[model samples]
Target: MAFDAVVTDLDGTVVRADGTVSAATLQAAHALSAAGVPLLAATARTPTGVAALTTLAPHLAFAVCCSGAVGWVPGAPEPAWCELLPRAEVADLVAFLTRELPTVALAAYDSRRWRMTATYQAMRPNTHKGPITVVEAAALPEAEACTLVLGHPDRTPEQLVAALIEGGFDPTRLGLHRAGRRFVEVTAAPIDKASGVLRALRVVGADPARTIAFGDMPIDTTMFAVVGRSVAMAGAPPEVLAAATDHTASVEDDGFARALTALL
Candidate 1:
């Protein structure tokens, strides 16, 4: 298929373990832009987290953040689109989760800022970014959140999801997704990377059938479902691999660059 755009996840797809984009990946992005193909960032990161990509690739003007609840161009004062959870619902969910899993740390984000419980704040490393406010879980009702993040130092992503299910969170009512080994995220129902990608596609006037996507996690499955071609990383989970149209080398092996070379 002739692709008009290339969408990729950030953490495990294009970024290396040292939290840097490889030279090969950067070259591929430049090549795509020179060829008139748009390169978009689709990630579970917050707007703040996605902003970091702009410094690495100036061609990346558009990004889908918070799994799909928000879409924006880095450096823009406002987002192009945002979907937030109702205040009442945010309060209820936090109340229930804290009661059920007292050990889990909770973090919440609106369109502009991230706030976490004091316990969650204390868990951050010295290298963690600033501007994240420390707030009580009870304050969740005061802030309209686009995403709610649950983290447990001891539990894996799978365990966190299982615990949420057992705690009365209906997976169908919310986008319950495991973003990584230590974090499980909850967004408004039916929002995922695919929703963000579709919004980005519309913004860019790109065709779904001609859009190629690269991802490595279950949250990325939604994007895979909508795109014409889905490239899963070598080390992607079994389900992600099964859903993809093709497979590429692991990120550590410069899989993104290799895949882009073949496709471009």
Candidate 2:
């Protein structure tokens, strides 16, 4: 196979539910390094969240964080690049959401700290980093941020996205992705895993057509469409599986290692 580069999703792919990387995966990572293939990560997680994967840090050359809105080198203090939400556009979106989803709570990640509505605090409770600032809903739109968080107490993330679309919310100007725990992440328009992966590829001098990706979520589908080869975990949903060029065992079964081993 001889892939030039490998980009993988963290959770549900290489990282397990309990946040551990299997020994086989580590061995495969070392194998990739030995073969001179740079390993990259594209995740919907914030840099802080990605930092939790301490064991996998040494394997990654770069991490595409915040669903492509931000890029970071594993232990870097700042992002390589970050795209923030347009203030006026955010205000307009907030106004629209207020009318369409009255119960929806809003939060902003300004690349520094999170400023969230009290309602968001109640709903997400203790999940955010410390010094979380509870602010009024109206103030959230004014906060400078690379990503926005939208959630509802009554509606699932999927339902919330559906409701927004049905209400004529234009997602084209912004990126919206369903994330863990009943929330949707919104980033600046045109920001996605593919864009971030391309950034890393450019720096690594890897041919995009020779890059292989591994993932198990819908978020990974975008990356799948751009990369040369895409390997979906066996237990992934049908759409994720459909988007991939190959299939591997589940994460618990060391699917990431199995795929990389085969490719090498």
Q: Pick the candidate with the highest lDDT.
A: 2
* Per-residue lDDT of candidate 2, residues 166-227 (tens digit): 76657888788876647898888788888889988898888889999999988789999999
- Alpha-carbon local distance difference test for all models: 0.83, 0.85
Candidate 2 has what TM-score? 0.91
Write one digit per residue (lDDT tens) for candidate 1, span 1-264.
Answer: 369898999889998777888888888888888888888899887777776655454768589988898998867878888899767767778888778778778888888777888777766443234367888888876878899888877878888888777877777778888876578878888888888899899998899899999999988999999999999999898999999999999999999999878866
Q: What is the TM-score of each candidate against the true structure?
A: 0.93, 0.91
Which ranges in model 1 have alpha carbons more than 4 Å from their true place?
Answer: 124-130
Q: What lDDT, from 0 to 1, does candidate 2 have? A: 0.85
Alpha carbon deviation, residue 238, candidate 2 (Å): 0.9
- Return the TM-score for candidate 1, rounded to 2 decimals: 0.93
